[model samples]
Target: MRVALCQIEVGDDPKENLQRMIDALRGAPEADLAVFPEASMVRFGNRLADVAEPLDGPFVTALRKAAREHHTAVIAGVFEPAGDRVHNTVVGIEATGEISGSYRKIHLFDAFSDRESEDVAPGAEPVVLDLAGTHIGVITCYDVRFPELARALVDRGAEILAVPAAWAQGVFKEEHWTTLVRARAIENTTWVIAVDKAPDRSRPPRGAPGGVGRSQLIDPMGTVVADLGPFPAVRVAELDLGVTERVRSILPSLTHRRPELF
Candidate 1:
């Protein structure tokens, strides 16, 4: 399967962000899957409640239309209304423009002096979407730090992990992001499609840049297939599904785990 990683700079306006996403999809190379960064509907450091909408809202509805028009499956982040707070969500749309599934971030961003749980509700389940005969696991932003979630998704037959992040810029933050993403791919022996937001000057957090873009696709053996630097860009690469089986045959780490002891 071919995948397109779209690194875009998000803004505070939902309509503008939606249009930007559509434009990116329109201009991107034709692929089976296209991914965008977290909070693609609106950037962070702003009131999420102001632009939070349901799955059936205009933001996602427009994305569905764009996905159908482009004939590419999409997995992008958006905020969803959840009671008084909002859910940090990643919605999966099939190439046929149908809703595949949604993953509300199970692990909220509570570290680094940022309190995501204050305004965002935590999710209780891991979601995997079946698109074009491949099972893709959905994880958003901070959830990439947790290995247990990725393991659980692999256990549920996930061949590829779709990671959409709005990673903050700080000292050693870029290294942490890259290391964690590669670790997940190597440990789980699953393909990782990590797409991060581009540097945004309009919406910086704590007087620093919001996203340090190094969006990449990693193979099961932790080999980076492609990396889009720290800027707004889009790149498409072919994903050979058979590589997972070949790597597993050599390493076979997942099969050696002793679950009873842990």
Candidate 2:
């Protein structure tokens, strides 16, 4: 199936951010699945509480409408309310505009002196959504650091890994993002679709690091099938599910794992 990665500029306004997301999805090229980066619903700017909303609220409702219009399954991030804090969530909406499932970010961003857990609650479960005939998994930014999460999704019959991220820009950050994305695809023998914010190449945010775009699609053999440079854009690529099976047939790493020892 084909996928569209929407790399948008997530500024500080919740209203503008939501409208941008809608516009991107509506104008997306023909693809079976459309994915957006984390915090695409609204810019948290480190203050998630101020912009968090319910799953069935305006943000998702608008997304569902766009998905129905484009006739493509949509996967994007949203800040779902979780008690006093919020959950960094990536939800799946079918082409029919039905809610498929949601994956709350298990690995919150707690590195680089930023305390994500202080404002966002951690998720307890991993989720997989079936798009068309392909079994796809979902995870947010930091969760991509943990191989176990990807393994669990593959174990749950996921053939593709969808990562919606707002990867922060910093020293060695770009390298880390590319390396980790490719590693996940190689090891799990799954298609990896990672969408992140477009970095301001000329300037950083408030003299602080901002999101690094570099949205990419990796084949099961770890091939960089498509890469959207650090800019606001929409990238579409077709991923064949058979490639995952073919790679697994040669490597068989998933079945060869000694889970009991590790």
Q: What is candidate 1's local distance difference test score?
A: 0.90
Candidate 2 colliding pairs, count:
0
After TM-score superposition, the amount by which residue 161's alpha carbon in candidate 2 deviates from its true location, in angstroms, is 0.4
**lDDT, candidate 1, 163-205, per-residue tens:** 9999988889999999999999999888999999998766454
lDDT of each: 0.90, 0.84
For TM-score, the strongest prediction is 1
TM-score of each: 0.97, 0.94
Instruction: Show the colliding residue pairs in model 2.
Output: none
Estimate the Cα RMSD of every predicted model relative to the unseen true structure: 1.3, 2.0
TM accuracy, model 1: 0.97
